[model samples]
Target: MLYHIRCKKGDKTVRTIKEVVGHHFVQGQPGLLMAHCQNDERVFINFDHFDFLDFSNGWAKGEAIVAQKAAEAKKNEPPQPPPEPVINGPGGAS
Candidate 1:
């Protein structure tokens, strides 16, 4: 199952766990230990700094979150200008 972790800080940094390798309790609260699916990186997230954790739909929710982020990023980007028209040489169409 996938897990989404949101930071309680003002920047609100978000991290996604494709798969949780292990977990432990911190002061009776749960903490998740995640390993990267692509690399050797590992992350440990404490329950205290978590603003939100979504595990309801797992994969589906993660996909929705990714799509939502992509849409938001696209919305914030400036409109791109169209390409200039190309002129072909005569010669009956080069």
Candidate 2:
């Protein structure tokens, strides 16, 4: 789940887990953490002087965990073999 944050510029964007905030960090704002999209990798915000949004388990943190698992799963995915070509000739076994 990718997180979302309303940028200081008032534009909403997807966030990444590498964004550092304080003792913790936030990926996106809050309401955009579960969307499937190609990573933009630039929605992270640093609210250093702002109050923390102490949600249970911290949505950003949770997203990090989930994202890690997802990456691992992708890495473990089985490699697909290439398709065979058609061979139409004498003695060709069907």
Candidate 3:
């Protein structure tokens, strides 16, 4: 069956994060599945066995660390050499 994900009412909704928590079960499942939704209203995948706080904190820190590494890499990269002239007058050097 098809389902309707959440919809937004106003422009302000686009700028924020929204979360929905629910329990799901299948016909022969041993236990109900826990579900979550993000602002886009897309269903979030399970965390395996992580608690909510642990997941959130870990995600935030991971993102920060990744960004920091990227920034550091950019800062430490070697500068590019200037392009050589198309024509050289006499000397071997261009």
lDDT winner: 1
Candidate 1 lDDT trough over 10 residues, lowest sum: 21-30
The regions of model 1 sitting more than 4 angstroms off are 1-59, 90-94
lDDT tens string, model 2, 1-94?
3333332222333332333232222333332233222443333334432233222224543454465456666767899899887777886746
Query: What TM-score, over all chains together, does every model reach?
Result: 0.32, 0.29, 0.28
lDDT of each: 0.46, 0.39, 0.35
Worst 10 residues of 3 by lDDT: 48-57
Summarize candidate 3's per-residue lDDT along 1-94 as a digit string, tens digits: 1222222233222222234433232223322223345343444322222222122213332343354456567767999999976666766556
Please say which candidate is ahead in lDDT: 2 or 3. 2
> How many clashing residue pairs are found in candidate 2?
2
Error of 3 at 62 (Å): 0.7
Off by over 4 Å in 2: 1-59, 84-94
**What C-alpha lDDT, on a 0 to 100 scale, does residue 78 get in candidate 3?**
100
